[model samples]
Target: MTAQTTDTVLYRGEDYDLIGLIAAEPITPQDFGMTPAMISTACYRGYFCTYAIEDDRLFLVEMTLRERDGRYLPIGGIQPVADAREATCSYKDLRIPVDYTGSLRLASGFVRECYIHMGYQKASAFETVLDFSLDAGRIVRVHDRSAEAARKRGAFKKHFEENVAWGIQESFDLDMDIW
Candidate 1:
């Protein structure tokens, strides 16, 4: 939501125009799977800047990423249900990548999940836990218990169960390079 202007002038007895580049929206909703249920909020934002010249033009490009995390409740508005009908599991504080601010043609999305170990260096201590991409969605029934640890072996133990909401949670955008 910033302003940019171009100027035209005669330099060295030569006439020329300096046309500024077009500004594009940096975020959008579709980047995430779910739509805005009720007012959406941006959970996080990141930006990368570069100063470079190309084709005799000075350019300042920025890459930005935004996250939207919020969900709806069931009927009473206090609790959350997948839908008003209560068919699917209710989600809370869903996170989605915001693609509303950038060019619709160059948006990107992805998800990654990994485990986190709670206790290490001790035989009795619990270790290894599953960690999902928060920007991807919400999860439930995921926990790390000592008994579950005993059942599993290897460097990966500390077991936990989880589910995803598939709601819009996070996203990133980058400027296209000509070269």
Candidate 2:
């Protein structure tokens, strides 16, 4: 597993990297009759999504996919297109409302010390963690758990430094065999 690219979320006029899987309405490349090709190791999922929280509602703002020719193309949102291949739309248009009523974990200010090599990082790897509750895509509540995350990170760092011989390395490269 490689370092996967993160999905973006615009919340309260600020963009934050989504920490974990979004438990929203499932929308895939196959739904649009396209098989996206992976263009780089950083994007193992072959696609990435951009979301926005406007007026307390969650919207799927954009979806980008890698073509076989290695060119990244927009597949959904932000445009009036007849099909997925012709997805050239402006940023202001085409906000697909997501019917998601669940909790969302968003993170920012990545902590380099807690870096993991494979897949989406855990919430603890960030300096700030925001837990959001939604009802049918509308944001119902928000909780900032930055201090708790910081405390957990500190404890992990202390344990690692005291036990592991490699003292406080900036990054930890995991063995591919573990995958």
RMSD of each: 22.7, 7.3
Candidate 2 all-Cα RMSD: 7.3
How many angstroms is residue 25 displaced in model 1 relative to the true structure, after the best TM-score fit? 27
lDDT (10s digit) by residue, model 1, range 145-170: 33443344322222222211211110
lDDT of 1 at 15: 26
What's the CA error at residue 21 for candidate 2, in Å? 3.9
Residue-level error in angstroms, candidate 2, position 111? 1.5
Candidate 2, residues 1-179, lDDT tens digits: the string is: 45577778988877887764346433555555556676467775566678898998888777766545443334353332333453322233547787687777778888887765545555666787887788887889988877777767744445444655442232222111111
What residue runs in model 2 are displaced by over 4 Å at the alpha carbon?
22-26, 31-33, 67-93, 154-179
**Best of the candidates, TM-score:** 2
Best by lDDT: 2
Q: After superposition, how far is residue 53 of candidate 1 from its true place, in Å?
A: 38
Score candidate 2 by TM-score against the native: 0.67
